[model samples]
Target: MVIFMLVKDVMKKPITVKDNDDLTEVIKLFREKRISGAPVLNDDGELVGIISESDIIKTLTTHDEDLNLILPSPLDLIELPLKTAIKIEEFKEDLKKALKTKVKDVMTKDVVVAKPDMTINDAAKLMVEHKIKRLPVVDEDGKLIGIITRGDIIEALV
Candidate 1:
């Protein structure tokens, strides 16, 4: 017999983050919960965006335009170790600034969501089409209720 599984049956009560929350605290939460991403909620508790490890990684690799445009002098090039040390120090400073960034600054604002009554198969198709791993499950009034992930669907099938 074929069973039709709805998103509500497998979706987990979402662990959400506030849009104005700092990245440093969000990172701590992600680590503690062992979650790769979470839906961003506003003060009114509406899903406003989504954040993931991918977004954090993007911040790390964001290059400084001025730094990239400058060409090191011949003397500076000869002092390779000194150049490397300076670069490391600058990178450290950048990381510090990045950590203080707010969730809204880096989150994907145009979020794709799923309804609780939606079928698991349909949700999976949405995941594949959007190239996303999770979908925030919302209510009729577009309020976040839970989260559904690829893992959840896989586990439900087993």
Candidate 2:
């Protein structure tokens, strides 16, 4: 199918975070916006990076990479529920602690961006190649103006 749609046709104003923003604030912004990721901007409002739930998840789990959070055993049946509850509480605490860091520390600096005039097909290609869910739409001088995502493209196409 030939798509004449341009990125600007479907791009939405970006929900952004500052480089120095604390993860706590960023996390809250994400939750409030119901967004999985956002463009990161510098003090001069230049798009510098991108932060996503993957970044937060990686930060939260610096060490606990093993899936062996709990082991199943016949003798452990009675303790499973209590252990699970405790693990959940511990994870919450870890999340709070992880928020002490700045957004720049964990944000992906090597971001792939889209131009307003770019075709939706081209933008989709970039996203697929970069394995990113969202693409920041930047102007000629690289100023972030809007953002587009897989969902946005799909919605627009339909």
Candidate 3:
């Protein structure tokens, strides 16, 4: 039986980010909220792109002739920085890097946005093919309305 439903009907409220936002801030939100991704919005609040943990991971470790140049090893990351040890200059530089990186830097700019009137099967198929856990639901105007995740699909299935 065909599940004839629009993505808007099942999508969750979106957690969004601006095009000029610091990716580091986004990362914190992801960790606290346990979400894999979020939508990126332009100044006019249009759907620009999507950013996922995998995207951030790519930035941290790019393939360089079979060598990886990752910053702050997993063990070192666990050691929380003391208040005094935190240098303002260093923090500022990191923030600058994140802002300059732009949403386009790590976001999936070639997006496969879901329209309100797509079948559940079609959406699921796209997600599977793209290896993405979520799909942003948008209107014809390219304005984001919500998002649908694998969890949402599973909940509907059961």
Best by TM-score: 1
The positional error of residue 62 in candidate 2, measured at the CA in angstroms, is 4.4
Q: Give per-residue CA lDDT, model 2, range 1-158, as digits (tens).
A: 43889999999999999999998898899999999999999999999999999998788874544324366677677776787788778878887888898999999999999999999999999999989999999999888999999999988877
Query: For residues 1-158, what per-residue lDDT tens digits would candidate 3 score against the true structure?
Result: 43776576788999988877777777888989989899998898888889998888766553224222357577555553542245445556665665456666789888787887887778999999988888899888878888999888877776
Clashing pairs in 2: none
Ranking of models by TM-score: 1, 2, 3
Local distance difference test, candidate 2: 0.90
Error of 3 at 145 (Å): 0.9
Q: TM-score, each model? A: 0.90, 0.80, 0.72
Could you arrange the candidates by lDDT from highest to lowest? 1, 2, 3
- Kindly report which residue pairs in candidate 3 clash with one another: none
Backbone clashes in model 3:
0
- Candidate 1 residue lDDT tens string, 1-158: 11488999999999999999999989999999999999999999889999999998897785645344258777766776666778889989999999999999999999999999999999999999999999999999999999999999999988
